[model samples]
Target: MKLTVLVDNNTYIDQYYAGEPAVSYYIEIDDLKILFDTGYSHIFIKNAVSMGIDLNAVTHIVLSHGHNDHSRGLKYLREQYALPNARLVAHPLCFRPKSYENEYIGAPFSLEEINRLFCYQPAEAPVFLSENCIFLGQIPELYSFEKRKAIGTTIIDGAEREDLCLDDSALVCRTDQGLFIVTGCSHSGICSITDHARKVCQDQRITGIIGGFHLFDTDSKLEETIRFLSDLSPDMLYPCHCVSLKAKAQMLKYMDIEEVGVGLTIQL
Candidate 1:
């Protein structure tokens, strides 16, 4: 599998690609070309073009969650390219209207519009896009500390209710060595997501993990998460987007963390 960072919150000094407070990754596994998340705006599209990646060639568009920073780029992608054959894979509630403290922070397009545009495949169960790549749907809270906390509100069935981010998920790629996890903002708790991925993939060994952990402080949760990850001992860790530098530094105390930025590529 080959993965390229199309958009991220950081960029290498000489990479020249534009940076944004978002997340998007272009992944190629076997014959499949998968796009994970879309970032905040046209920045992903711009970075993709500059990185020599053709959006139109994407075979799958996967959303890790419904947050704007992770999914709002769909509008720009639709305007700039035509990916008629690409199938959209995400949780059923991912397209529902979402807001945090009265501010809209959901995907730019509605589920109806998405259905019409691409081969929409709403999943609440693990679905395999290919032999090795699987979308972990509706991550379960497997640990007591990583309990689900309502972020804000979401409109469902004409009624607004607390959004526990049940739609939040991640992608697990099975490799010869172990599982490689890709995620957007892990509102469902990074450890919970990893546990669910292990359950779904039936693989205990984690080769690596990339994308946001939604961790920002040096609290008990962060310490516990670091311990959990340290136990797994993945070869590499690329925690970006919602993760703060302090949290990264704390993690570095126990495990190795790779610097992630736009134009960065990883081959596994």
Candidate 2:
């Protein structure tokens, strides 16, 4: 399996490009091609094309959550490419007329916006791309400390949402070597994602982790996360997107890590 990062929150200082937002990643695994999230805009498409990826060839678009930065490029992508049959997999609430509120200026996408963007396909559920690849829809929260972090709180119709991370989901792949997990923001909590992967794959070790860890904080939850990962011991850690520099530094201390960003490719 090979993974290519098309967009991310931080580009290597030498690989800088203007207008791209905090994070995004495009991954290629065996014969399957997947875009984890579309970045904050159409920039992902531009970056992918510049790097020799043809959007028309993508077979699946797995959204990790519903925040604009993660799902915003959908409209542009479908307009620019020909994924007429590509399966878009995500949690049922991904189109929950939501926004990110507490962490930053949360911009909840209006239902009208979703309709205009995806041409209005109702939120999809667990979708299997291949025997070895699967999308875990509506991940069952299974950890005490790993509760969903409060982000993107929005008023849907009348009620205020405190845990509106309904758009969160995780993807798992059972490669010949072991299991590989690709997440978007990990808003549902990283530990929960890994648990779901293990449960679904039945005793497969998580060999690699990629995409936004949602650890962009001064008081970020790295210490506990490190302790948790120490038990799982994934072979490699590829931190990108909302992961903090401090978290990356700490991850290196615990396990093998590969820094990733736009235009970079890795053969796993």
Best-matching candidate per TM-score: 1
RMSD of each: 0.9, 3.1
**Candidate 1, 142-163: lDDT as tens digits:** 7777788898999999999999
What residue pairs are clashing in model 2?
8-23, 9-22, 9-23, 98-108, 99-108, 99-152, 100-106, 100-152, 101-152
Tell me the whole-model lDDT of each prediction, alpha carbons only: 0.92, 0.72
* TM-score on alpha carbons, each prediction: 0.98, 0.85
Q: Alpha-carbon error at 128 in model 1, in Å? A: 0.7
**Candidate 1 regions with alpha-carbon error over 4 angstroms:** none
* Candidate 2: tens digits of C-alpha lDDT, residues 1-268: 7777777766777765533654556667767887777877789888877777788888777777777888877767867886766766666667665545345433245556645544333434556677778787877778776676666465565787765586688888777668888888887788888888888779658888887777765343677777787788887778777787877787778776787767777666
Separately for all candidates shown, the number of backbone clashes (residues 3 or more apart, or on different chains) is 0, 9
